[model samples]
Each structure stands twice: as structure tokens, then as C-alpha cells.
Target chain A: MPLLDWARTQWDRALGALAVLIGAILLLVGWMKISDTGFVSEQLPYLASAGLGGVFLLGLGGMLWLSADLRDQWRELRGIRARLDATADLAE
Target chain B: MGILLGMARLHRKAGAAVCAVLGLAIVPLISADAQADATYAAVAEATGTRVILTNQSIPLNVAPQLQGPTASAVQNSLQQSDAYAAFPYPGEEVAGIPGVVGGAAGVPLPAYPFVIATSFGDGAKQLSYPGIELRAESTETLTQSTATGGSTGAGGTSSARVARDGDDVVAKAVTDLDALRIGESLVISGLHAVATASRDSAGKLTRASELSFTRLSAPGFVIGLTNGKFTLQNGTEAPAQNDVPLAQIAAALSGAGYPTTFQVPQETPDGIIGAGLQIQTTLPAPPAGTPGGFSGETPVTYTIGLLRAEVAYTVLPTTPAAADTGVDAGVDAATGVPGAPALPTTDLAGLPGTVPVLAPVAAPVAGIDLASLQASRAAVGSDVGWIYLMVAAVGLAAVGGCAVLYRGAR
Candidate 1:
């Protein structure tokens, strides 16, 4: 149960990090391809595909990371609600 | 059923992974080396005032003359028989073919056609080149010729003459202007520019370009340029521009009550209403070990008014580089020459060139001058600001994403 709880909380963050790392690597490779090539025509495909793909991965990683923050905020809101319910019961 | 349900839950991550892999794979596959779609050994072109223009673009190497079936037959006979052994006389011959009299020796060798000559000049009085007073002219003559050849003991000797205009290599282009009205307040006159190259008998290559103008004038203003020239010897490379003339032109404009702004030439999306001059000469290298041979195409171009020349060397798989939008980029209101400031004086002077402007000049209506009207119209021209702003927004979002991602990593 403890291991499951830890995995549940850290999964998004871990995946986000992996995605960011892969995206950065892709960007570096794309830049190297651009600088290594002689002709502008030869660089076009790599620029369009690798460049855009890296950007897409980076965006996805950022979104997933932000979602973790929102998930934590939601948990805090639930705790606050439960405490309010407990106070109301005690009053009753 | 359980596997399918699990796959559905992880579909987003699965899709992202597939896209990343596909994106990485596609780069190498699609970017395989493509052979050059087109190739040119040399190209030369020039333009000025739209009317005086010239282009001399010779395609890749070609044999000077064609050897059709007859020539081929002669070559075949020479190779097959003893035509190389003895000189064949007209009356007496007994060779490989039974009926053949003189053998291959009697057939006159093809004339060595080794010269290309092109010339252009404006003849009509049409207002094609507005600023030009004298007729625009451009000429290029290149010659590579062999005089005579004789076969001796299984080999042959031929005499070649590299005579460009007779053993000389020469390229010449000229565009001149008498007067031009850039805007309501500015008039330029007596402009002459020439791009020329010639090789002397001693094998010395000389390139000479000249630029001069009488004055840039308006109602109460006038300015003159010191002559501009660029001359070099025996080299394939030349300076990019005739900087002396350009600097003198700028100096003259600045002196004649105009702003001192020297702007680089750029391809403007919406063309400018102005006059410009450009001339280029490219000469091919002589064939190796051929004495007295001038081998190259000579092209001459002339223009007046506005001109645009674009030479794309390769067929790009994607769209070419972006041209200047001329939007939100500060430009002179009347002339549309970017970076040139608006003229302060509003005096509308009559065009004072040899070639007259026949159309009756339009008077300023409702107290608005032509320059101001031009500026207002330019303001309403296509705006590329939104596109740039969108790019900027995306850039900012990427920065924000980086910040968030960095913090999460930490």
C-alpha cells in the first residue's frame, strides 16, 4: 500500500522528467544535423521533423508536470473540505 | 478484454511515444542527399531603371560544333582505314570503301565555332528608361576558335585562336540616366555607370567599372558626385559592389539636402517606386593548355526605373528564404527606398531630364502633398505584424514551459 501510494504520487513527475530529457536530446541531435550539413535543402526535413517533435515533447512534459501541481492543489482542497465536515459534526 | 482496457487508459502516453519515434525516424529518411536539380558553370545579369537590363547566362559546357553523321562517318573511316598514313588527293584514292576517292582527308574540317557575341541598345524614344538621356547599351563578345588541322602519322595538329573580338576577352555593360524624379521633392540627373572587362594581347586581364553623375537636384537644391571606379587585373574574383561610386552617391544625396542613410539592397515584398542601377560581368576560365583562346559567353544588361532580378541556383524542396516584408520597417514615404528618410522640403519640381515626363503633373489636392499621400497608402499596405506577434507569443509560452519544467525537475 505504501509503495503504491509513493508510485501514484511520483509517476507524473518521473514521466515528465523522462519526456523532457528525451526532448532535449532530440533538439541537440537536430541542431547537430543542421550544423553538420552543407546544403540548406538537406537540412529542411530534419529541421521540420526533429525540431517540431522536440518542441511537442517539451510541451507535453510541461503539461504533465503542471498537472501534478493541480493534482496536489485538489488534494489540499479535499482535506480542507473534510476538516470543515469534521468541525460541523463536532458542532452538531 | 483486460489488455484492451489497460491500453485505452494509457493511450495518451502511447500516442506521444509513437509520435516521438516517428518524428525521429522521418528526419534521416526524408533528408537523403538529393542530386542538384540544376547546374550552371557561370551566370551574369544586370538591371537598372527597368529599361536598361541585360542577362548573359550560358548553360554548362557544350562542344563548340556538332559532328553529325557525315563527320562521324569521316572519323570512322579515318580510324578504320590508312587515312592517317597518306594524304588523299582529289583525283586518285583507293581506301577502305571502294567508291571513296579522297578518303577522309578531302573532307573540310568543321569550322571551330568558339565565339559568343550579344549586344543590346535602346533604340525607341519610349519612356522605358526615364532617367537615361543617352541610349542604354550592353555588349559581350567571347571567341574560341581553331583555324586549321592536319593529320600526320596517326596524330593531328590544330591551330587555335582565342580571339574575343579577335584574341581578346571582353565584357561591357553600361546604363546611363539624364534625370529621375524619386519623389515630389527630389530629382536626380546625369547618372552613368559602366561594368567592363577586357584582356589584352599580353594575357593581362583588366576590369574597369565607372560611375558618375552630374547632380541630384530639386527646386533650390543640387549636388554632384565625384567619379567612381573599380579596376582590377588578371583575377576571377571581383569586389561585391563598386563601393566608391556607392559612397559618392550617398555623399551627394546627403549634401543635396537629403538624409545621410546608406541602406543595403534587399528584396522588398511590395516593390519600391525608385530608380536603381546594377551591372555584373562573369568571364569563364580559358580552356586548359589552349593558347590564344578566349572561351566564355558575354552577356550585357541595361535597365531604367525599377528592376528586380532573382536567380535561384537550385530548386529548393521547401519555400525559399523570406523576403523583407517592408511592413513596420521604417521606409521613406515617397520613394519607398527603405531607411531613406522622408524629405523635409515639399517643393514639387518639374522633372528635368532629357527624357521628359509627358503626363501632366497632378497638383496637390486638399493641401495633401504627394509624399504624405504615398506614406498614408504605404501605412495601409499589408501588415505582417500579426504573424510576428504570434511567433513572439509562442516563444514566450515556450519560455514559460521551460521555467515550469525546470522547477519540476529540481
Candidate 2:
């Protein structure tokens, strides 16, 4: 199957890949910005923030790609338990 | 007492023998030192060197005014021109007097003079007018071989060798000074060397003598008067018509008591070439009781353009030949004399066999410094390596997490 078709069937994985791609692009942009800035000591903070943000996005994308469906199922279970408690309170 | 007398006599005899040997050795050393000093003195004398300056009057067509934008443009053009490089002179010094106005003595002056003062009226009495003095100089060298007679050394061996001699010629332009004016322009166009030669240290012909000529032009300006009363204008406009005939300028200069008839030698001597112009003028003096304490009757301004060409013939001393062992006698027969000029060859048909093979030396590559290469590599590794590693790690983690989720779902 074509990779695009597979990504359509598995949207979570595709979203995770897209997030990772974005992170990689951000990292490349950060590197280019730092190089253009001539590695000035005053610009280190901005470069560090950009690099950290890219890493965080990559981690979030990876987690979402892996367990996005599982996370939705856990939310549905919590909602069912809350409805059961409300029905018992009405019977009392 | 007899033993003591005998010992003292023996000591005196030994000391006298030592002194005699020392005197014999010192005599040869002193003689050799004196001979070397004499040889050096002869070389330093540089005898029979000749310097000649032949002046050829080159007529001026139009005197271009050097002032304002035109002056600046000409200066820029001269700076970038090859003539300026060939004959480099101080343009500022050429235009003004050294140390009289305000410039370091011996420094190269500008080609144009700076205007110091200006005044109006015909009777403005001034001692002198600010005028330009143009000077140009060139130097060339030639070498000639002369056979020196054989001189016997201590061993009675005849040392016949060739000696080189240097001849120098210096040519300068001469002009009379009665036709110059504050706003007048002067242009000299032709100056060159008639002949030149170059030879190697061995006195062998490297470059033959050739006849050649160089055209050089030096334009000048006269700015102001010295007594601070006469008006002098240094504008860009030509003092005379741009298309004015050369004969007319010559006539006016002649009427003003300046030499207009410039004569040229029927034959220019070898290694000598020069050209220049002379201008002279008498400005009317200020009337009696004029302001600024003026008292001169009539001040005359005389300017001359001097172009000099100097040629130097340099001869390097003969280097001593290495000692010849018995093994080189056969080689000497084929090579002939050590410092003799090589015979002309008509063709290269026998060159493949006669030519000696030489191993080529390795040449260093251009534009590649090892230190810079290493530094650049280190910079790329440090700046870009971590980003690539982070991206790779994130990609692998995402792939692994996705695989685990798929398995759990199954």
C-alpha cells in the first residue's frame, strides 16, 4: 500500500509523523538562526528556547502517535462510571 | 751556578725559534688580506660610468587647465593610468614650491600647484606668482662583458676571466622661464629611451639591446602671486581657446620675451631622450601708495619643465669556479668554457639524447590550508551534529511507540 493510504487509515501515526517532521523543521530553523546570529552570547537564550520547544513537540507527537486511541478509550470508561454513580443516587 | 746558566740559555733559544715560525705564518696572512682589500676597492670604484641628458623640444598643442572638477577627474585618471606608474612624481610638489608655502622638503609634490592668494587690478605689485615646476625622471640598466687579463696567483696559475662593466646615462629637459602665466597650461608629450640592454651575471647575453620610446605627458597650473596683491584665477576653463594653434601660443610666448623656437638635434644620441617647455612673464607692478604695503616695480614669473632619463649599467662580480678534480677533465672538453655564451642551435633534432633527465619536484596545492580545513570540520561537527542526533532519536522513538501500540491493539 502507498504510504499516503496507510497514513489515511492510521491518522494518529500520520499526525505523529507530521509533528515529528515539524519538530525536525523547527530544529533546522533554530540551527540556521543560531548560525546566522554568529553564536553571539546574548542570543544563546533564544536559541536554547527554540531547541527545547522542538524537542518537546517531538516527544508529544510520539506519545500521541502511539496511544491516542487508548487515551480515547480511557476517557469513555470514565464517563460510563460517572453515569452509573448518578443512576444509583437516583434509585436511593 | 753552571747548571743554572745552561738552563736559562736553553729557554732563550726555544723562545727565539717560536718567534721566527710565527713571523713566517703572519706574513702570508697579512699579504692575502691586503690583496683582497685592493680587489674590493677596485670593484667599488665604478670607473668610466657615463651619464648623458639629451633635450628634444616637443611642441605643445593645447595647455589643459587643471582646476575644479577637471582637476579632480584628471588626478583620478592619472592615478589609475599606466603613465603615472611608469614615471611616478609628486604632483603637489610639481605645482608649488617646496618649504616656501607649507610642505615637507624632499617630499614628492603634486603635479598641480595650489592657489594660495588672489587679487584684482593691473597695478597689483607682487614679488612672485605661485607657479608649477614639472619634473620627470626614469632609470634603466645595461650590462656588458669585457675580457680581463690573466693574473697569476701564488701558485703561478693564470686566471683569465671576463669582467662586466656598467654604463649609465641621465637626460634632463632644459627650458627658459619668461613665458609662464598664472592661468596658462603646459603639456609635454614625448619622453623615452633610445636603447636598452639586459645581461645575466655570467656576462652572457640574456636580452639584446633594442630601440624603444615612451610617451609621457605632464600638465601644470600657475595659481597665484606671492606679494598677496595680484589677482590669480585658477578655474577649470582653458585660458586660451581649446582649438588654439600651437604656432600662435609660440608667437605669444615669443612676443613676451620667452624662447618659443625649440630646436631638436638632427640625431638623438643612444640612451638619451628628453622634452620640456619654458615660459616667462612680467606682471605690472602696483601703483605708488597702494594698499597692503606693495612696493615692487614689476615681478617676473619664470617656469621650466625638466624631464630627465637616467640609464644604469650594472655588472656583478665574477664568482669563483669550483675546484676541478681529475674526474671532470672529460666533462670539461664537452662543456667548453664555464662562463662562455652558448652557441646558437638551428634545430632540436638531437635534444632527446643530449638533454639530461630531471626529477620533478612536488608542488603544494593552492587554496588549501590544513589548519583552516580542520577548524571548519570541527565547527560543522559541533554546530550541526547534535541537532541531527536529536532528530534521529525522536524518529526512532516514535516508530517504536507506534509498534507497541499496534501490538496491544491486536
Candidate 3:
């Protein structure tokens, strides 16, 4: 099955994963602000390049997660519609 | 009585005959011994030798007239040639003067290697240190500079003395000596062993020794005076632009080698100045034609550029005991040959008032030590720009890691 179809049946797992990831993001941001605040000015050139490189990597990962989450919802809704039609047929 | 007289006469006649025979027998042995000595003396005269140590030649007459063995039979006769004692001169008594004890004095008032000095104002009236020689692995004049201040009032104490800055100081020095064993290893052709060296009774170098070179890089800083203005040499007319900044000079020096920038700073009264050249450890070739003549010429080329030097210092006079108020510019006191053109001095004519100014050289970093551009990189301080950049990169990595984790959980 497509990964999106699989995620549709695993709502609890996806939400749990997202919560852990957000926590990690907050922790890393705090560490950077605390460890090297002066890095913003003194090494601006290097900091900008590194920041852009980091953002690209993160955006890619987030995009993959978002794509998988949407695909799962679509698969789950289709599965519900098919089951509902089968029930209606039994009723008739 | 007649019988006794006859017996005594007979004994005297017999004793006389025996003495005559003994004298004849000794004559041949004595003649043979004399013959042997004559032959050995001829051989020793032929074999004994002496060696030359300088421009002087050795006299060939010290061999003894006696000889024994043609080889080992001849006694080894050797003498120090005339060159051994010819280098006597009277000027070696002062400090830092180099040469044979009695030889012609080397360049006068010889300053030792690795020295640093700072001088300011007309006649170094503001401040100076006499002997601030710093002996280390290497030394160089990173910059020579001058700067002027806007005076608050004419003849006021503030306007009277030209405040000396470190950028106005000049210095140059050499750290290495090139020792050549060429002269020390005498090459001769007459002896059985070809060219051989002579050693003293203690088996040390008694004859010619290796040639060694002493490098003296003289960085010039003559103070000029005009009105109430003072400046280190900037080779220019404007007092405002006379100063050579130190930070820029240091960066250039630490990157290149010695710097040759002599910018005459403007003194209050005079605006223009011409700089004398300094070529230390100069090696002049035969000029493509002649064989020898230790003459002088402008062998090095002078370069110009804006000097930058960052001078970090404790107070010029931190302690009285540690201060050097008397400057013995050793050159003038030397005896034989004259010292280098009285190391460009400070002008006293326009020196404002009777301030009793002493141009004692303080440890001023010069910008004109550009004698060798090869070693400049090592002379400057360390740069830590890359380290700062790395720290910033790590900060960015944290941001990336956060994004990765957030996406993975989602």
C-alpha cells in the first residue's frame, strides 16, 4: 500500500511522532541561542550559509512528512466510504 | 840527584806521545757528526712551512737550519706566518664593537641583534630609551610611521610638544648569521697533505677559520622639527599625513617580510625630508668586471605603501629603575673607522623650548624593517578568524537538527 494509505490507519502513531519532533526542534533552538549568541554577527557569512543549509534539510523532511500524512487521510476516507456502501446494500 | 832527573824526563816524554794519538782518533767522529747536521739543516730549510690567515702573507724564514730524517728523520718545523699578528687595531674597547682585539674596529657603536626602541618628538624630547635590544630568534621593523594632532593653541603646553605615537617609531634587525667555513678550511697546494690548516697547541683553530656573516638591518627614524610640530621620518611634507599607522603595517609585515617604507613625518618648521638608505649584510659582487673592492651602492630597492600597526603597550615609563634614560648610540665613540652616518638624528633647531629633550630610543616597532619580505608572515600575531566562523557553523547545524527531528516525528 502507498505510505499515505498506511498512515490513515495510524493516527495515534503519527500524532505521537509529530509531538516528539516538535520537542526536539524546541530543544535545538534553545541550545543554539544559549551556546553561541555572538555567532550571529561575528560569523554572519558562515552562519547564514549554515542556516540556509539547515533549513533546506528541515523543509525536505517536513514536506515528506506532510505528504505522507495527507495521503493517509485520503486512503482512510475512501476506506470508510466503501464500508458504508456495503452496509447500505445489506440493509436493502 | 842526577839519576832521579833522568827518570822524570823519560815519563814526561811517554805521556806526551799517548795524548797525541787520542786527539787524532776523535777528529774523524766529530767531522762525521758535523756532516750529518749540515745535511739535516738543508732538508729542514726545504720542508718547514707557514700559513696565511688574512690579507697578510706568512714569512718563509722561521725554519731551523738543522734536519735529521728525509721523512720522519727531518724534525717537523712550523711557524705562524706574518699574517698572524697583523690585525691589531685600537678601536675594539667599546661595547658591541666587533673585530680582532687589535684589528681595525668594525662598524662603530655596533648595536647587537634583536633590539627594539621607541622615540618621539623633536630630539626624542617627548620620550626615549637608550638600549632596548631584544635578543631573540628573529627581529624585524614591522613599521615606521608618524601622526600629527590638531593643536589647541600656539605655544601652549599642548601645542609645544609633538606628542609621539608608537607608529612614528622605526626599527630593523637581523636574526640569523651565515657562517662560512671556506676561509677556515685553508686550501693550500705545496705541502704533502695539500692545503692543510694549522691548529694551536691546544688543538683549536689557530690558522684560518670559517667565514661568518653578521647581518645588521638599520631601520631609520630621524625626527624633524617645524614650529611646534614633530614627526618620525615620513619622507613627506604634510604633518597631518606624516604618521605611519601600525595595525596596517603589522598586517603587511606579518604577511610579507621586512618593509622598506620610509615616510618622512613633518616637523612643525620643515615640511620636506629626504631619507638615507640602509643596506645591512650587503653582498656586493664583482660588478661583472673587477675582482675586488669593498665599495658601496644602492643594492636594495625601496617600496612605498600605507602602513598599519596596532601597538599595544604598557606605559612608556612604567618604572624608574627599569627605564633607560641614557642612550649610548655606540657608533660615535668608536675609534678607527667612522660609524654609520650618525644614525639619522632628531632636529633640535625648531624644538620649541628648553625641554632638555633626549631622543633615547624606546621599543618602538618600525614599519621599515621590510629588508626581507619573506619572513613577515611569521613576525605578526596569530589570526583566529576561521575559529569564529566554525562556531557560527555549529549554531546553524543545531537549527538543521531541529528541523530533521520535527519532520521525522511528524
Q: For residues B105-127, write the lDDT of model 3, one tens digit per residue.
A: 54344442222222221121111
Poorest lDDT segment (10 consecutive residues) of candidate 2 chain B: B69-78
- Candidate 2 structure quality by residue, lDDT tens digits, B140-172: 111111111112110000000112232112212
Which stretches of model 2 miss by more than 4 angstroms? A1-92, B1-6, B29-182, B185-277, B284-289, B292-299, B305-410
Q: Pick the candidate with the highest DockQ.
A: 1
Per-residue lDDT tens digits for candidate 3, residues A1-92, read: 75577358555434433433443343234334322321112223433444344334433434444444445446656767887998999999
On TM-score, the stronger of 2 and 3 is 3
Which structure among the candidates has the greatest lDDT? 1
Question: What lDDT tens digits, residue by residue, belong to model 2 across residues A1-92?
Answer: 78789678657756765775676566556555553421222124434565666666666665665465455445556767888999999999
- If ranked by lDDT, best first, what sequence of candidates would result? 1, 2, 3
True contacts kept of each: 0.02, 0.06, 0.01
- Candidate 2 TM-score, true structure as reference: 0.20
- Write the number of the candidate with greater DockQ, choosing between 2 and 3: 2
DockQ (model 3, Cα): 0.01
